[model samples]
Target: MEIGKLPNDMLQNIILNKIKHFRNDILVRPGIGEDCCAIDFGEYSCVMSSDPITGASNEIGRLAVHVSCNDVATCGVEPLGLLVTILAPVYASEKEFDEIMGQICDTAASIGVDILGGHTEVTDAVNRFVITTTSVGKVLKDKLVVSSGANPGDDIIITKSAGIEGTAIIAHDREDFLLERLDAHDIERAKGFTGSLSVVKEGVIAGKLGASAMHDVTEGGILGAVWEVATASGLGAEIYRESIPVEDITQKICNIFDIDPLKLISSGCMLIACKNGNEMLKALEASGIKASRIGKMTEDKETFIISRGKKELVSQPGTDELYKAT
Candidate 1:
C-alpha cells in the first residue's frame, strides 16, 4: 500500500463498497472526490469533514485545522467549529503537547472557528504526534455544493498556485537539507507559503456565485484534483498544462527532488467548475484571490492534459509526491 491516500480503485473496492447508507437525512455520503458530508438539518445542511495531519511534523496543529476546514469549504460552507483529537507518542513532552494545543487554539481563533471538544492522550501507539480534526459547518440545503455536480461544458478554474502546501511543508520540515542546495531567501519564501493555505474565502465566493462544483486540492495536487472532479462528475476534462501556475520557489524545490510539481500536494488551491468561468474569475479577482481558468469539462469520458500540441492521458493518482520529498 502507498504511504498517502488509498488509490481510487482500492478505496472503491474495499472501503466504499462495504459502507451502507441507511439514513434519509444524509445528503452526501462517502465517495471519491467528496470530502465533506452534508446532513439535512431542516432548512439547512450541516457539513462535516475529518482529516489527519501526518505528512509534516512542524505545524501539525495548524495544518490539521486548515486541512479539515478546507474540506468543509469545498462544499461552499464556512466552518464554524472543530472537534480535534490528538494522539501523542510516549516520548513526547508536555511542552510539545502544549505547543500543539496552542497552535490549534490560535489557528481556530484566526479562522473564526471554535474548538469544541476532543480527546488528547500520550500513548505508545504511534511514533510521533498525530492530530486529527473534524470540522463542522452549515449551509442552506438549496445552496449546498458537491464535487459530483460539475457539468460538461463548464470551465475548470484553479485558485492559487500548485503545490502550495507541499512547498511549505518541505521547506519547513526539511530546512537543513534544502539550505544546503538552495538560497536561504528562497527557502524562507517557500515556508511562507503556509500563509496562503486557506481556501474558505474563495470557496464561499464561488459557492455564492453558483459554481457547479468545487474540490479542494489536497493530497493529490492539481492534476489529481482535476481527475477526481471529472471522475466524480462522470465527465472528462481537458487541462492546458501551461495554464497551471507554479511558483518559482516551488519549482526549484521540486527540481531538487526530481518530483513533478503538478502531482504534489496543494492545500491552498481550490478546483472549481462553473458555467461562466469569466464571471467566476472576475469575482475571485475582486476579492484579491489569484485564479486561472486552466481547462474545461468535456463530453468525452477520457481526461487528458494537453501540452505543446500533445495530449497525455491522466492516470488515477497514486502516492502523493509529498511523501517522496518528506
Candidate 2:
C-alpha cells in the first residue's frame, strides 16, 4: 500500500501467510529481516537474493548490483555471480540502454561478480526503466549466519554512518534542489556515499569471527533494521541514540527534508549481533571499516530507544522516510 516496503503486519498476514515451506534443504527461508534465502548443499550453502532498483533513477544500474549483492552479504556469504533482468520503457533510447548496461558491467566487474545470462526487453509495461538482479553466493555450512540467530545479551554493532545510501540517493537525485539550499561541497560529499555501499568485507569479517546475526540496513534504515533483528530473534533491544553514527552531510540533508536519519533507507550501513562487541569492533576497525556498538539484545520482547536520559518504544516501520523526501 505504501511506496517503499510493505508494512510488517500486512506482509506477514497477506504474503507470508500463504507461503509454504516445500523443501527441507532450505536453510534460511523468507522472513522479515531475512533478505536472502540459503539452500543447503551438504558441505556448503548457496545464498540467493533478488532486489529491484526503483528508488534512484540516476544510478539505477549501480544500485541494482550493490543492493542485490548486499542481500547475500547479509547472510555472511561471498557473492560470486548475478542474474539480471531489465524492463525498459518503449521510449527509452539506445544510448540510455547502453549506459545502463555499461554501469552494471563496470560495477559487477569491480566487485568480482560475473553477470550471468538474463532477459532484457522494451515494453509498454511502465514509464521508466526497471532493473532487478538475483545475486548468488556461497558460504561454508558452519559459517552461515541469519538474522534470527541473535541471542540475548549479544551486542548490536552498526557499521558505517546512518542513512548513507539514502543520503547519496537524495543528493544525486535532488542535486539541483540541494545545491540551492546547501553548500556544494556537502552535496558532493553526500553523493559520494554511493562508493561505500558494499559491506561484503565487513560482513565476511564479522561472520567469520563469530557474529550471531547480521542484517544489512536498507529501506528501513538503522532503527528499522534493529527492530527487525530483534523481532526475528524474538528478543528486544536497547538502542543508544547517542552511539548511532550519523554523518554531518546526512544530518543536514535529513534536516532539510524533515526526516529522521535513523528511519531513512540505508544500504551502506549494516547491523551486527555478536556476543563480544569489543571483538567485533576491533575486527571491523582493523579491516578499515568504521563500526560502533550502539545497543544490546535483551530477553524481553520490547524494543526501545534511549535518548536524553529517556527511553521510548520504537514503533513498527512503515514507508521509509526517504520516500517522503523524494
Candidate 3:
C-alpha cells in the first residue's frame, strides 16, 4: 500500500460502516467524496470537515485550525465556527499545551471563525500531541460547490503554486539544514507562506464569479486533488505542467528530495473548476492571488497531465504519494 488509498472493502468495513448509523434528522447532502460534508441545517446547508496535525509537529495549533477551516472554504463557504480536540501524551507539558491553544485561538480570531467546543484529554495511547479541529460553515442551497461539480468543457484553474504547504513544513522542520544552504531572505519568504493556508477570500470570490467546483489541495498535492475531483465527478481532465506556479525554493526542495512537485502536499492552493475560465482567472488575479488556467476538463474518462519540457505524464497513479513519502 505504498501509494494507494486503503482498499475500498477494508475502508467500508472498518471505517465507513461505523459512520453508517445515519438517522432521519441527519441527512447526508451531496454525499461522500466531496471535499466537505454537506448537511441540511434548515435554512442553509452546513459544510463540515476535520483533520489532525499528524505530519508536522511544529505549529500544530495554527496548522490544525487553518487546515480544518480550509476544507469548509473549499466548498465555497466561510468557516463560521470550529470544534477542536487535543490529545496530549502523558509527557506533554502545560506551558506547551497552553501555547498551542493560544495560537489556535489567535488564528481563529484572525479568520473571524469562532471556537465552539471540543474535548481535551491526556492519554498514553499517543506519543505526541495531536490536535484535531472540526469546522462548520454555511453554504446556500443554490451555491453549493462539490468536488463532483466539475463538468466537461470547464477550465481548470489553480491558485498559488504546487507544494507550498510541503515546502513550508520542510523549511520549518529542517531550519538548520536550509539555513546552511539558503540565505536568511529565502527562509523568511518560505516561512511567510504559512499565512497562505486558508483560501476563504479567494474561494468565496470564485464561487461568486462562477466556479463550478472548488477543492483545496492538501494531503495529496495538486495532482492528487485533481484526480480525486475527476474520479468523484466521473470525468477526465488535461492539465499543462508549464501553467502551474511553483516557487524557486519549492522547486529546489523537490529536486533535492526527488519528489514530484505536483505530488507533494499543497494546502495553500485551491483548484477551481471554472465555467468561464478567463473571468475566474481575472478575478483571482484582481484579488492578488496567482491563478492560471492550466487545463480543461474532458470527457475521455482518463486523466492526462503534461509537463513543461517533459513528454511523459506527471500525473499521479490515482493515489496519494504523501503517505508513502512520509
Candidate 4:
C-alpha cells in the first residue's frame, strides 16, 4: 500500500510466499536483504538483480544502471552485462526516447557493461517513461558474500552519506522548488550526488577484505537497510545515530521537507557487516571512499537505535520518506 518498497510482512505474505522452488541451480533464493540471486555454475556463480526507475524524470538511465549494478555488487559480483526494458507512454516523443536510450548506452559503456536485448514499447499502461534493468555479474563460489552471513560481534559500517540518492533526486526533479529555499550552490552540489551512485569500486574492495555481509541502501534508506540486514542474518543490531554521516545539503533539504535523512532513499551509500571495523575502514579510506563504523551486531534478536542518549526500537522499513516529496 506504500509508494516505494512493500513492507516486510506484506511482502512475505503476498509475494515471497507464493514462490516455490522448482530448480536446483538456484544457489541463493529470494530473501529480504539479499540483493542478487545466485545460480550455481560450478567454479563460479552467476549473480543477477533487477530494478526499475520510477521516481525521477531526469537521469533515469544512469539511475537504472547504478542501482542494478549495486545489487550485484552486494554479492561481491562485478557486473558484466545488463538487460534493459523501457516502457514509455503513448504520448512520449521520439527525442525523449533517444535521450533515454543515449543515456543508457553511454552509462553502460562507461561502466564497461554491454546492453543486451530487451523489449521497448510505448503504451497507455503508464503515464511516464519507466526503465528497468537486470544486471548480471559473476563471482567465484568461494568469494561470494551474502546478506545473511552477519554474526554477533560483527561491526557495521556504512559507506558514503545518508540520503545520497534522495537528495540528488529531489534536487533534480524539484529544481524549481529547491531553488526557492536552498542556495544555488547547495542545489548544484546535491545534483552532483548522481555521480557517486556507483559502489562497484568499494564493493569489490570490501568483498576482498572479507566483509561478512553487504547490502545496498535503496528505497527505505540507511535505517531500513540496517533492519533488513539484521533480519536476514537472524540477529540484532545497535545503530549509533551520531556516527552515521549526513551531508549538510542533505540535512538542509530534509529539514525543508521535515523528513528524516536516515529514512530516505539512499542508493550511493552501502551497509557492510564485518568482523574488524577498523580494518574495513582503513581499506575503504585507502581506496578514497568515506566510511564509518556506525554500529555492531548484537547477540539478541532485537533491533534498536541509539539517538540523543536514548535507545529506541528500530521500526521495520515502510515507504521511503522520499515518496512524500516526489
TM-score per model over all chains: 0.99, 0.98, 0.90, 0.98
Candidate achieving the largest TM-score: 1
Q: Name model 4 segments beyond 4 Å from true.
A: none
Model 4 Cα lDDT, one tens digit per residue, 1-326: 55777889888899999999999989999988889899999999999999999988999988998999999999877899999999999999999989988988988887788988788999899999999999999999999999998999999999999999999999999999989998999999999999998888778889999999999999889999999999999999999999999999999999989879999999989899999999999999998999999999998788899999999999899889897777
Superposed model 2: Cα runs more than 4 Å off: none
TM-score for predicted model 3 compared with the true structure:
0.90
lDDT of each: 0.94, 0.91, 0.80, 0.92
Cα lDDT of model 1 by residue, 111-179, tens digit: 899999988988899999999999999999999999999999999999999999999999999999999
lDDT of 1: 0.94
Candidate 4 lDDT score at position 142: 93
Residue 301 C-alpha lDDT in model 3: 73
Q: What RMSD, rounded to one decimal, does every model reach?
A: 0.7, 0.9, 2.7, 0.9
Pairs of residues clashing in candidate 2: none
Clash number for candidate 4: 0
Please tell me which model should have the higher TM-score, number 3 or number 4: 4
